[model samples]
Target: MNLSVSLASGEPIYQQIKEQIKRQILSGELREGELLPSIRHLAADLNISVITTKRAYDELEQEGLVASVAGKGTFVTEKNKEAIREVKLRQLEEQVRSLAAESRMLGLSKQDVIGLFDLFFGEGRH
Candidate 1:
Protein backbone atom coordinates (compact mmCIF):
# COMPACT_ATOMS: atom_id res chain seq x y z
CA MET A 1 0.00 0.00 0.00
CA ASN A 2 1.23 3.49 -0.86
CA LEU A 3 0.56 6.05 1.83
CA SER A 4 1.90 9.49 2.67
CA VAL A 5 1.27 11.93 5.47
CA SER A 6 2.09 15.61 5.25
CA LEU A 7 3.45 17.12 8.41
CA ALA A 8 2.61 20.60 7.04
CA SER A 9 -1.06 19.79 6.48
CA GLY A 10 -3.56 21.48 8.75
CA GLU A 11 -5.20 18.15 9.50
CA PRO A 12 -3.67 15.99 12.20
CA ILE A 13 -1.48 13.06 11.14
CA TYR A 14 -3.94 10.48 12.38
CA GLN A 15 -6.85 12.15 10.59
CA GLN A 16 -4.85 12.43 7.38
CA ILE A 17 -3.94 8.76 7.57
CA LYS A 18 -7.55 7.81 8.31
CA GLU A 19 -9.04 9.87 5.50
CA GLN A 20 -6.54 8.68 2.90
CA ILE A 21 -7.02 5.05 3.84
CA LYS A 22 -10.79 5.52 3.71
CA ARG A 23 -10.50 7.15 0.29
CA GLN A 24 -8.36 4.28 -0.99
CA ILE A 25 -10.89 1.72 0.20
CA LEU A 26 -13.88 3.65 -1.13
CA SER A 27 -12.19 4.23 -4.49
CA GLY A 28 -11.62 0.46 -4.83
CA GLU A 29 -7.88 0.85 -4.80
CA LEU A 30 -7.78 -1.47 -1.82
CA ARG A 31 -9.76 -4.59 -2.55
CA GLU A 32 -11.98 -6.33 -0.04
CA GLY A 33 -10.03 -8.83 2.08
CA GLU A 34 -6.78 -7.18 1.12
CA LEU A 35 -4.25 -7.36 3.90
CA LEU A 36 -3.12 -4.01 5.25
CA PRO A 37 0.40 -3.37 6.36
CA SER A 38 1.07 -4.05 10.01
CA ILE A 39 0.62 -1.05 12.25
CA ARG A 40 4.30 -1.00 13.16
CA HIS A 41 5.30 -1.36 9.50
CA LEU A 42 3.04 1.43 8.39
CA ALA A 43 4.27 3.66 11.18
CA ALA A 44 7.84 2.97 10.17
CA ASP A 45 7.03 3.65 6.51
CA LEU A 46 5.32 6.94 7.32
CA ASN A 47 7.89 7.85 9.96
CA ILE A 48 5.07 8.56 12.40
CA SER A 49 4.18 7.15 15.78
CA VAL A 50 2.64 3.69 15.93
CA ILE A 51 -0.20 5.11 17.99
CA THR A 52 -1.15 7.39 15.10
CA THR A 53 -1.39 4.50 12.67
CA LYS A 54 -3.25 2.44 15.24
CA ARG A 55 -5.73 5.25 15.73
CA ALA A 56 -6.42 5.36 12.01
CA TYR A 57 -6.87 1.60 11.90
CA ASP A 58 -9.16 1.76 14.92
CA GLU A 59 -11.36 4.29 13.18
CA LEU A 60 -11.44 2.19 10.01
CA GLU A 61 -12.53 -0.86 11.97
CA GLN A 62 -15.20 1.20 13.73
CA GLU A 63 -16.48 2.37 10.33
CA GLY A 64 -16.73 -1.29 9.25
CA LEU A 65 -14.27 -0.81 6.43
CA VAL A 66 -11.68 -3.16 7.89
CA ALA A 67 -11.26 -5.92 10.45
CA SER A 68 -8.50 -7.22 12.69
CA VAL A 69 -7.91 -10.89 13.24
CA ALA A 70 -6.17 -12.64 16.08
CA GLY A 71 -2.51 -13.36 15.25
CA LYS A 72 -3.21 -12.16 11.68
CA GLY A 73 -2.91 -8.57 10.50
CA THR A 74 -5.66 -6.17 9.60
CA PHE A 75 -7.59 -6.72 6.38
CA VAL A 76 -10.04 -4.66 4.42
CA THR A 77 -13.54 -5.80 5.33
CA GLU A 78 -15.73 -7.65 2.86
CA LYS A 79 -18.82 -6.12 4.44
CA ASN A 80 -18.35 -2.70 2.87
CA LYS A 81 -21.08 -2.95 0.26
CA GLU A 82 -23.57 -0.70 2.04
CA ALA A 83 -20.83 1.32 3.63
CA ILE A 84 -19.34 2.00 0.20
CA ARG A 85 -22.68 3.09 -1.21
CA GLU A 86 -23.23 5.47 1.66
CA VAL A 87 -19.73 6.89 1.34
CA LYS A 88 -20.19 7.53 -2.39
CA LEU A 89 -23.55 9.15 -1.82
CA ARG A 90 -22.13 11.45 0.83
CA GLN A 91 -19.31 12.40 -1.54
CA LEU A 92 -21.77 13.21 -4.30
CA GLU A 93 -23.89 15.29 -1.94
CA GLU A 94 -20.89 17.34 -0.88
CA GLN A 95 -19.89 17.92 -4.51
CA VAL A 96 -23.41 18.99 -5.46
CA ARG A 97 -23.69 21.28 -2.46
CA SER A 98 -20.46 23.06 -3.39
CA LEU A 99 -21.51 23.32 -7.04
CA ALA A 100 -24.89 24.71 -6.08
CA ALA A 101 -23.28 27.42 -3.96
CA GLU A 102 -20.89 28.32 -6.79
CA SER A 103 -23.70 28.39 -9.33
CA ARG A 104 -25.79 30.69 -7.15
CA MET A 105 -22.86 33.06 -6.76
CA LEU A 106 -22.53 33.06 -10.54
CA GLY A 107 -26.23 34.06 -10.84
CA LEU A 108 -27.21 30.82 -12.57
CA SER A 109 -30.82 29.72 -12.45
CA LYS A 110 -31.81 26.36 -11.01
CA GLN A 111 -32.51 24.95 -14.47
CA ASP A 112 -29.19 26.23 -15.72
CA VAL A 113 -27.34 24.70 -12.79
CA ILE A 114 -29.07 21.37 -13.31
CA GLY A 115 -28.31 21.48 -16.99
CA LEU A 116 -24.67 21.97 -16.15
CA PHE A 117 -24.83 18.93 -13.90
CA ASP A 118 -26.40 16.88 -16.65
CA LEU A 119 -23.70 17.98 -19.03
CA PHE A 120 -20.96 16.94 -16.61
CA PHE A 121 -22.48 13.64 -15.52
CA GLY A 122 -23.53 12.70 -19.03
CA GLU A 123 -19.99 13.08 -20.32
CA GLY A 124 -18.72 11.00 -17.41
CA ARG A 125 -20.74 8.04 -18.69
CA HIS A 126 -18.73 7.88 -21.87
Candidate 2:
Protein backbone atom coordinates (compact mmCIF):
# COMPACT_ATOMS: atom_id res chain seq x y z
CA MET A 1 0.00 0.00 0.00
CA ASN A 2 1.20 3.49 -0.85
CA LEU A 3 1.58 5.82 2.12
CA SER A 4 2.88 9.31 2.79
CA VAL A 5 3.25 11.57 5.78
CA SER A 6 2.76 15.31 5.80
CA LEU A 7 5.05 17.28 8.07
CA ALA A 8 2.97 20.44 7.71
CA SER A 9 -0.23 18.94 9.11
CA GLY A 10 -0.92 19.61 12.76
CA GLU A 11 -2.00 16.01 13.32
CA PRO A 12 0.45 13.56 14.73
CA ILE A 13 2.37 11.45 12.22
CA TYR A 14 1.24 8.21 13.80
CA GLN A 15 -2.39 9.22 13.56
CA GLN A 16 -2.01 10.25 9.91
CA ILE A 17 -0.50 6.88 9.13
CA LYS A 18 -3.20 4.99 10.98
CA GLU A 19 -6.06 6.87 9.35
CA GLN A 20 -4.73 6.44 5.81
CA ILE A 21 -4.14 2.74 6.26
CA LYS A 22 -7.63 2.35 7.68
CA ARG A 23 -9.10 4.24 4.76
CA GLN A 24 -7.25 2.03 2.27
CA ILE A 25 -8.50 -1.13 3.96
CA LEU A 26 -12.08 0.13 4.21
CA SER A 27 -12.05 1.26 0.57
CA GLY A 28 -10.94 -2.21 -0.58
CA GLU A 29 -7.61 -0.89 -1.85
CA LEU A 30 -5.74 -2.99 0.68
CA ARG A 31 -6.91 -6.57 0.45
CA GLU A 32 -7.28 -8.97 3.36
CA GLY A 33 -4.06 -10.80 4.35
CA GLU A 34 -1.98 -8.23 2.55
CA LEU A 35 1.43 -7.76 4.09
CA LEU A 36 2.28 -4.28 5.19
CA PRO A 37 5.78 -2.87 5.14
CA SER A 38 7.91 -3.56 8.17
CA ILE A 39 7.69 -0.88 10.82
CA ARG A 40 11.33 0.08 10.47
CA HIS A 41 11.08 0.25 6.70
CA LEU A 42 7.90 2.31 6.84
CA ALA A 43 9.50 4.73 9.27
CA ALA A 44 12.51 5.05 7.02
CA ASP A 45 10.34 5.63 3.98
CA LEU A 46 8.26 8.29 5.70
CA ASN A 47 11.27 9.89 7.38
CA ILE A 48 9.65 9.36 10.75
CA SER A 49 10.72 7.56 13.92
CA VAL A 50 10.28 3.80 14.23
CA ILE A 51 8.29 4.40 17.41
CA THR A 52 5.68 6.34 15.43
CA THR A 53 5.13 3.60 12.87
CA LYS A 54 5.08 1.01 15.60
CA ARG A 55 2.45 3.01 17.44
CA ALA A 56 0.30 3.16 14.32
CA TYR A 57 0.56 -0.59 13.74
CA ASP A 58 -0.10 -1.27 17.38
CA GLU A 59 -3.25 0.79 17.29
CA LEU A 60 -4.41 -1.04 14.18
CA GLU A 61 -3.86 -4.38 15.87
CA GLN A 62 -5.66 -3.19 19.00
CA GLU A 63 -8.64 -2.38 16.80
CA GLY A 64 -8.42 -5.88 15.22
CA LEU A 65 -7.73 -4.42 11.79
CA VAL A 66 -4.29 -6.02 11.43
CA ALA A 67 -2.43 -8.96 12.92
CA SER A 68 1.22 -9.57 13.70
CA VAL A 69 2.96 -12.92 13.82
CA ALA A 70 5.90 -13.75 16.04
CA GLY A 71 8.32 -14.63 13.24
CA LYS A 72 6.53 -12.80 10.47
CA GLY A 73 5.52 -9.21 9.74
CA THR A 74 2.18 -7.47 10.03
CA PHE A 75 -0.68 -8.52 7.77
CA VAL A 76 -4.28 -7.54 7.36
CA THR A 77 -6.67 -9.74 9.32
CA GLU A 78 -9.27 -11.47 7.15
CA LYS A 79 -11.55 -12.29 10.07
CA ASN A 80 -11.90 -8.70 11.21
CA LYS A 81 -12.39 -7.19 7.75
CA GLU A 82 -16.15 -7.23 8.02
CA ALA A 83 -16.03 -5.65 11.46
CA ILE A 84 -13.80 -2.91 10.12
CA ARG A 85 -16.17 -2.39 7.22
CA GLU A 86 -19.13 -2.03 9.57
CA VAL A 87 -17.24 0.48 11.70
CA LYS A 88 -16.26 2.52 8.67
CA LEU A 89 -19.79 2.45 7.31
CA ARG A 90 -21.18 3.72 10.60
CA GLN A 91 -18.60 6.51 10.74
CA LEU A 92 -19.52 7.59 7.21
CA GLU A 93 -23.25 7.55 8.01
CA GLU A 94 -22.68 9.76 11.03
CA GLN A 95 -20.71 12.25 8.95
CA VAL A 96 -23.43 12.36 6.30
CA ARG A 97 -26.11 12.81 8.94
CA SER A 98 -24.21 15.72 10.44
CA LEU A 99 -23.80 17.31 7.02
CA ALA A 100 -27.51 16.93 6.30
CA ALA A 101 -28.37 18.64 9.55
CA GLU A 102 -26.00 21.50 8.77
CA SER A 103 -27.45 21.83 5.26
CA ARG A 104 -30.98 22.06 6.68
CA MET A 105 -29.88 24.68 9.19
CA LEU A 106 -28.30 26.66 6.35
CA GLY A 107 -31.64 26.55 4.46
CA LEU A 108 -30.04 24.69 1.54
CA SER A 109 -32.58 22.83 -0.60
CA LYS A 110 -32.17 19.19 -1.58
CA GLN A 111 -31.17 20.31 -5.07
CA ASP A 112 -28.57 22.63 -3.59
CA VAL A 113 -27.04 19.78 -1.62
CA ILE A 114 -27.10 17.55 -4.69
CA GLY A 115 -25.39 20.25 -6.72
CA LEU A 116 -22.70 20.66 -4.08
CA PHE A 117 -22.14 16.89 -4.01
CA ASP A 118 -21.96 16.68 -7.78
CA LEU A 119 -19.53 19.54 -7.97
CA PHE A 120 -17.18 18.07 -5.35
CA PHE A 121 -17.63 14.35 -6.18
CA GLY A 122 -17.42 14.61 -9.93
CA GLU A 123 -14.22 14.16 -11.91
CA GLY A 124 -12.05 17.24 -11.65
CA ARG A 125 -8.85 18.32 -9.93
CA HIS A 126 -7.52 15.52 -7.83
Candidate 3:
Protein backbone atom coordinates (compact mmCIF):
# COMPACT_ATOMS: atom_id res chain seq x y z
CA MET A 1 0.00 0.00 0.00
CA ASN A 2 1.22 3.50 -0.87
CA LEU A 3 0.21 6.64 1.00
CA SER A 4 1.42 10.22 1.10
CA VAL A 5 0.58 12.64 3.88
CA SER A 6 0.24 16.33 3.04
CA LEU A 7 1.61 18.31 5.95
CA ALA A 8 0.45 21.45 4.18
CA SER A 9 -3.15 20.33 4.36
CA GLY A 10 -4.96 21.79 7.35
CA GLU A 11 -6.57 18.44 8.10
CA PRO A 12 -4.91 16.26 10.67
CA ILE A 13 -2.29 13.80 9.46
CA TYR A 14 -4.11 10.80 10.86
CA GLN A 15 -7.24 11.77 8.99
CA GLN A 16 -5.27 12.06 5.77
CA ILE A 17 -3.88 8.59 6.27
CA LYS A 18 -7.28 7.18 7.04
CA GLU A 19 -8.92 8.76 4.02
CA GLN A 20 -6.20 7.61 1.63
CA ILE A 21 -6.44 4.04 2.92
CA LYS A 22 -10.20 4.15 2.62
CA ARG A 23 -9.93 5.43 -0.95
CA GLN A 24 -7.53 2.66 -1.86
CA ILE A 25 -9.86 0.06 -0.43
CA LEU A 26 -12.86 1.53 -2.24
CA SER A 27 -10.91 1.70 -5.51
CA GLY A 28 -10.04 -2.03 -5.28
CA GLU A 29 -6.37 -1.26 -4.94
CA LEU A 30 -6.43 -3.04 -1.62
CA ARG A 31 -8.29 -6.33 -1.58
CA GLU A 32 -10.21 -8.06 1.17
CA GLY A 33 -8.02 -10.00 3.59
CA GLU A 34 -4.97 -8.03 2.56
CA LEU A 35 -2.56 -7.67 5.41
CA LEU A 36 -1.83 -4.10 6.39
CA PRO A 37 1.60 -3.01 7.52
CA SER A 38 1.97 -3.11 11.25
CA ILE A 39 1.35 0.16 13.01
CA ARG A 40 5.00 0.48 14.01
CA HIS A 41 6.18 -0.33 10.51
CA LEU A 42 3.81 2.07 8.87
CA ALA A 43 4.81 4.78 11.31
CA ALA A 44 8.44 4.17 10.52
CA ASP A 45 7.78 4.17 6.79
CA LEU A 46 5.81 7.39 6.93
CA ASN A 47 8.13 9.00 9.48
CA ILE A 48 5.17 9.73 11.67
CA SER A 49 4.38 8.79 15.23
CA VAL A 50 3.17 5.26 15.89
CA ILE A 51 0.29 6.66 17.90
CA THR A 52 -0.93 8.55 14.86
CA THR A 53 -0.89 5.48 12.67
CA LYS A 54 -2.59 3.51 15.41
CA ARG A 55 -5.33 6.09 15.61
CA ALA A 56 -5.95 5.83 11.86
CA TYR A 57 -6.00 2.05 12.04
CA ASP A 58 -8.32 2.17 15.00
CA GLU A 59 -10.77 4.34 13.15
CA LEU A 60 -10.60 2.04 10.13
CA GLU A 61 -11.40 -0.91 12.36
CA GLN A 62 -14.32 0.95 13.87
CA GLU A 63 -15.61 1.60 10.34
CA GLY A 64 -15.33 -2.16 9.64
CA LEU A 65 -12.78 -1.72 6.90
CA VAL A 66 -10.09 -3.61 8.75
CA ALA A 67 -9.92 -6.02 11.67
CA SER A 68 -7.19 -7.18 13.97
CA VAL A 69 -6.36 -10.79 14.74
CA ALA A 70 -4.63 -11.59 18.02
CA GLY A 71 -0.96 -12.50 17.64
CA LYS A 72 -1.10 -11.77 13.90
CA GLY A 73 -1.97 -8.31 12.53
CA THR A 74 -4.69 -6.23 10.99
CA PHE A 75 -6.25 -7.37 7.69
CA VAL A 76 -8.75 -5.75 5.43
CA THR A 77 -12.20 -7.11 6.18
CA GLU A 78 -14.41 -8.74 3.54
CA LYS A 79 -17.57 -7.24 5.02
CA ASN A 80 -16.41 -3.71 4.17
CA LYS A 81 -17.43 -4.00 0.50
CA GLU A 82 -20.97 -2.75 0.93
CA ALA A 83 -20.15 -0.39 3.76
CA ILE A 84 -17.29 1.12 1.79
CA ARG A 85 -19.53 1.67 -1.23
CA GLU A 86 -22.09 3.45 0.88
CA VAL A 87 -19.42 5.60 2.52
CA LYS A 88 -17.86 6.57 -0.82
CA LEU A 89 -21.21 7.44 -2.38
CA ARG A 90 -22.12 9.63 0.57
CA GLN A 91 -18.74 11.39 0.39
CA LEU A 92 -19.20 12.05 -3.33
CA GLU A 93 -22.66 13.43 -2.77
CA GLU A 94 -21.38 15.75 -0.06
CA GLN A 95 -18.64 17.05 -2.37
CA VAL A 96 -21.16 17.68 -5.15
CA ARG A 97 -23.41 19.54 -2.74
CA SER A 98 -20.53 21.74 -1.62
CA LEU A 99 -19.50 22.45 -5.21
CA ALA A 100 -23.07 23.33 -6.15
CA ALA A 101 -23.30 25.71 -3.22
CA GLU A 102 -20.02 27.31 -4.18
CA SER A 103 -21.12 27.74 -7.77
CA ARG A 104 -24.29 29.49 -6.66
CA MET A 105 -22.31 31.75 -4.36
CA LEU A 106 -20.07 32.60 -7.31
CA GLY A 107 -23.12 33.70 -9.35
CA LEU A 108 -22.90 30.77 -11.71
CA SER A 109 -26.21 29.47 -13.05
CA LYS A 110 -27.16 25.80 -13.08
CA GLN A 111 -26.67 25.76 -16.83
CA ASP A 112 -23.17 27.11 -16.41
CA VAL A 113 -22.28 24.30 -14.07
CA ILE A 114 -23.80 21.72 -16.37
CA GLY A 115 -21.94 23.11 -19.34
CA LEU A 116 -18.63 23.00 -17.50
CA PHE A 117 -19.27 19.44 -16.37
CA ASP A 118 -20.14 18.37 -19.87
CA LEU A 119 -17.11 20.09 -21.29
CA PHE A 120 -14.90 18.18 -18.90
CA PHE A 121 -16.57 14.76 -18.91
CA GLY A 122 -18.62 14.42 -22.09
CA GLU A 123 -15.81 13.07 -24.25
CA GLY A 124 -15.17 10.25 -21.78
CA ARG A 125 -18.73 8.96 -21.99
CA HIS A 126 -20.06 6.69 -24.73
Which is the leading candidate under lDDT? 3
- Which of the two, 1 or 3, has more lDDT? 3
The estimated TM-scores of all candidates read: 0.91, 0.77, 0.83
Tens-digit lDDT string for candidate 2 (40-103): 9999999899999999999999988899987799998885657876887899899999999999
Lowest summed lDDT over 10 consecutive residues: which window, candidate 2?
A: 79-88
lDDT by residue for model 3 (4-61), tens: 8988899999999999998888888999999999999999999999999999999999
**RMSD, each candidate, Å?**
1.5, 5.0, 2.3
Top-scoring candidate (TM-score): 1
Model 2 C-alpha RMSD vs. true structure (Å) is 5.0
- Candidate 1 residue-wise lDDT, 1-126, digit = tens: 788989998899999998999999888899999999999999999999999999999999998999999789999999658878987899899998998899899999999987886887777574
The residue-level lDDT of candidate 1 at 119 comes to 81
Q: Could you tell me which residue pairs clash in candidate 1? A: none
Each model's lDDT: 0.91, 0.91, 0.92
Off by over 4 Å in 1: 124-126
Instruction: Tell me the lDDT of candidate 3.
Output: 0.92
Which pairs clash inside model 2? none
Residue 33, candidate 3: C-alpha displacement in angstroms: 0.7
